[model samples]
Target: MIVKCIDNNNCSTLTLDKEYPVIAEAPEYYVIFDDKNQETTCKKTRFTIIEDDYFTQKAKATITELNYQLENEFKDIKQFTIRKNSKGEIKEISVKFKYY
Candidate 1:
């Protein structure tokens, strides 16, 4: 089995061999933090990722903990907020989805 993974600092993805399934809510933009400062960016819908979080060694443990927390904290979260750029593109939006 092969698993694919991709990361963009503020966002990270993990895909298992095309068998095991994982689901998540989509966000328009993602917020990131760096030594310089915090920033936001656009994200395309094609992979599994978590905004404001990374799948890294230093963060692996934290991410795992968050996964469990989100599942329960957002049990009834049918809506969230996502920020967008002036260009009308999803950029630097919050990890939270924006519900109508």
Candidate 2:
């Protein structure tokens, strides 16, 4: 099963063999099983099942669009940097242009 972390600082998707029990829950964080089925703690607001085909489709579309933009819009970009959060979710992108 695929799950998404709802935490803003760690908004990333994870694949798991099966669902696990919540070891603990708090106002800011919680604990659950990670992809390896190991007990892992995360933000309380994090971790949700990725249900339905709509989300998957949208994710693919978004990736395609991002690739297109990188190839076209950023063709002239001299340098760029991608910033991701703790969960490996992209947080910010910075681009630099060549000056001639």
TM-score per candidate, in order? Answer: 0.20, 0.30
Model 2 misplaced regions, further than 4 Å: 1-13, 16-20, 48-100
Q: Candidate 1 on 1-100: residue-level lDDT in tens? A: 1112343344333222221122322355323322234332324332344333234555688566557658888653455576787888986433443265
Write model 2 residue lDDT over 1-100, tens digit each, in one string: 3446544344233443334456666677656666566777675445665553468789799677668767897665688899999999999977676677
lDDT (Cα atoms) of all candidates against the true structure: 0.40, 0.62
Q: Report the error of model 2 at residue 34, Å.
A: 1.0
List residue ranges in candidate 1 displaced over 4 A: 1-75, 95-100
- What does the lDDT read for residue 19 in candidate 1? 18
